[model samples]
Target: MDSKIKISITNFITVIYLFCFLIISNGTYISTAAKIFFSILVFFSMIINYKKVFNAFSLWLVIYTLFVLSSVSWALYGEFARQSASTVVYTTICSLAIPLLLINNKKDLEFFYKIIIVLPLIYYIYYLIFYDVPNIFDLRQDASNQIYNNIGLYAAYSFLFVMIYQAEREKRNIYYDVFFVIDLFLIIISQSRKSFIYIGIIVILSMILESKNVLKTLLRILLVFVLLFIAYQVVKNGLFGDSMKELLLSFEGDASDSSYVGRMNQFDISIGLFNQNRFLGLGIGAIEYVCRFVHGQSAPIVDNDYLDILSDLGIIGMVIYYGFHIYLLIQYIYNKKKWNKKNLLFFVLLIMLFIQGFLIRGYFNNYYIPILLYLIYYDTKTLKQDDSTILET
Candidate 1:
């Protein structure tokens, strides 16, 4: 195969998926359409590029596939499970498509970074000028709380994109550093506790990684204080508006007012459900009915991804869910002495995924999980060989 053709096809597919993820941030119709197209792209890419098959079939990915199948098989209502299972299908396709289609070289990874950062900057601009303000502009009717969620997730994506890119390039470009700061700002403005926690963990772990000396450790401690003080001022100043405050504070409210407590109750039920089906799980989408019944009225969906998987997929599903994390930790340890820079980058990503999963019910989202997985896969692929630095450019 000609290198030019391969690069072109890879770049085109990469752009398409990045565009799809951005549009997904805006609404559901585009997201659904993008998922379908992306699936076709993955299948075609797989068939045409059979040599790349191994990239798609990591132990982690297989475990995830098994969990998906088990979820569908054990589903209390196959119809509802089928709908939820679409996420599983789309996720599998995207995960395979990533290492197959993207990260051919360091250059490709670098291009990926540019796209992730630039596109969301455009989206954030639109959000601020349009969605953030009322009467001045109106967003699509479907762009509601869900859109805000997409905003937070994409913002986190941008942060990780910058982190990995900066680490690999081994230079602190002012533009990317500024973008990281802005990413944190956007996260805070979004008033998403999950987002805050996502970056917070990254900062903490990065400090730990970089803190070889006592002075560096102290500086990191000071940095944390500064960040916390700034956050307190931001919240106290009411920068994110009443709705954001209410959402954040909902975590501490009483049983009557606590949406957070509802998720806790659901978590307890999920544990009970997991006990009943320790291995196979109740199957995906089984717990929505359970949640509905428990709440009496329709329970607003929970965001604790781990609990959701626990109740629906059980312990086996949890293993599948965490397979990538396990693989990543092992990979990091193996490469620890060779590349401190890449190790730190992987550490940031691992912490972000762990924190975000716990803080939000994000494990089953059709968009972000695959993106995170692909990012890790590509990072591993690139870091495995120093010569493949095309993406770093």
Candidate 2:
């Protein structure tokens, strides 16, 4: 195939699967068909790039999925376990692997990352066109007129992506300005508290990583809190409305409030369940078991991804599940030897996926695939060819 045609074909197939993922959970005809179809496309990509098939990173992906699948033997809900296995397979092969093989250079990385960053804005556009925008605008509906936190969470970090892009470039340009604004607008309209805090963390991390002066970074951190105070005092009511304001203040309430305690009781239950099967785990989506057998709820539906992964997958699963991320982190650090943008970028992503509520429960998908793709893409494209620079202008 001609180089130009090959690039176009690769990108086209990738876009199809990417869109498939955005709707893969709908349980609709299109959703089911798209997943199966795009999964086949993923296979085709793998077959065509068979030399990269056994790449160490790619093998780890398969191993990770197999472990998730293995949990079905002990899964509390076999169907959910199958679904979890299916998700890992789909995400691994389609989202992570295909993109990994396709992105062979800095140009590919920039284009792919740009699309990932813009996806949230595109989804927002779709929601505005299709959903009840008035209710969402007034905070009557879920933020972004969608039940999931996908838009806000992804959008918040898209700003950080802009910084990553900046790292790739010699200088900032108008694309940075436009994307920063679009990312901020999407995050704000979604009113996701996690997203809000994610942005704050990104800002602080950027200051700390990019600057050498300790005093300047500390002052920037302090200035962040000052600006935060102003936003709390004035911006919430005007921009996000009363509902969001109430949510913002929800944290300041008594920690022992019944609502808060009720929410955390599940976590307590999760810990107990983990102890029971600490080594092998209860299976993926084990929290649903926690919710059902223990709490009588319909689903696991917890916000904490770490607990969700730990309780369901257990110690062995934890090592495999997190092992891939650790692998990527080590690869990037080895390839890029500085306290670079990619280091802090990956750190923020790990924290979000680890400790925070970047949940699978209310998301189209987790950001894991994108992060994996990024880490691998950087390593493969720029691996220790001395004096090599970052992304193309």
Candidate 3:
């Protein structure tokens, strides 16, 4: 095969892997599909492009190893352990695949970005127009699927990337701008306050750190605040429907509400679990086990990431996970000294993501973290700006 053809094939695989990850049914089968495709692509790319592995191994290979080990050791339930191991390996492959198999040059980055930039926004729009109730885009308070929030996260990330591309090229694509508006509108409508807050932080930090155009940044900030105010008014006032209005206002509306009290009560119970197993934790999968045992249920419905980690992996997992963030911070700080503007903006965006991971429950979930890990690895290794370099397949 021609070298360019081979590279294009690999790039296509990378894009497919991402698409499958983000757009598939969020079905049990979807993850199996991702796992299979990622495994094949990563192995094929590794064998073909053996050299990049050594070059980029310093960035992510070790982290992958540690995560695998920890997940294996911590997962107490047999099934959960197996699933956790599967998830960790899948993510590791995806994290390494981009830099190793595809994205060897600027064109590769653009190619990858072009695909990524739109799908997430489209997914959000689909929900906004179709699945969502008339005029309401937010997920309900009881929403627990990792996929929904991951779409929002993906949208936020894509918007930030679009902004960077716009700033860098001194141009604006109306499509990206439209996606941004739709994404924000959907976020508010979905009533996912965490997504909005995380995006807000990233935007503010990026504006402060990267954009030289202060007036533009200020205008953007003003616009966001105004939109947020409008969303709050609309949601709080129940403009969409009584159920959604009640849902949005539920967080602050009633102390006696069962959902509100239940989460608070669960947190209190988790606090006791944490106190008992402060360091080693209850063992991997222990929370689910305990929940099942206590509630006579098959799975623990724990939504808080902090409590989940503490209960399942104990303090050991917490330390290593947070340590990973510290390492990422060091990488960003080091890069800032050398300072590529796009990279700096990415670092700013990631910092918010890391913070949000702790503050929100979705961070530890397999869907979004792997993508974030892939970006970090890619940023760490990609240096040259050439657009035509063929990737290895």
Look at candidate 2 and tell me the lDDT of residue 307.
64
- After superposition on all C-alphas, the RMSD of every candidate to the true structure, in Å, is 5.2, 4.6, 6.5
Mark the regions of model 1 whose C-alpha exceeds 4 Å error after superposition.
Answer: 1-9, 25-29, 56-59, 125-143, 170-172, 222-257, 292-300, 381-393
Q: Judged by lDDT relative to the true structure, which candidate is superior, 1 or 2?
A: 1
Q: How high is each candidate's TM-score? A: 0.81, 0.82, 0.74
lDDT of 3: 0.61
Count of residue pairs whose backbone atoms collide, per candidate: 12, 0, 10
Could you tell me the lDDT of residue 338 within candidate 1? 51
Candidate 1, run of 10 with poorest lDDT? 133-142
**So what's the TM-score on candidate 3?**
0.74
What's the distance in Å from true for residue 131, model 1? 6.2
Off by over 4 Å in 3: 1-7, 55-79, 124-150, 210-253, 256-262, 296-301, 335-340, 359-365, 380-393
Which candidate ranks first by TM-score, i.e. highest?
Answer: 2
Clashing pairs in 2: none
**Displacement of the residue 104 alpha carbon in candidate 2, Å:** 3.1
- On residues 174-235, what C-alpha lDDT tens digit does candidate 2 reach at each position? 65668888777777767666677778777766665555577877887788789788878764
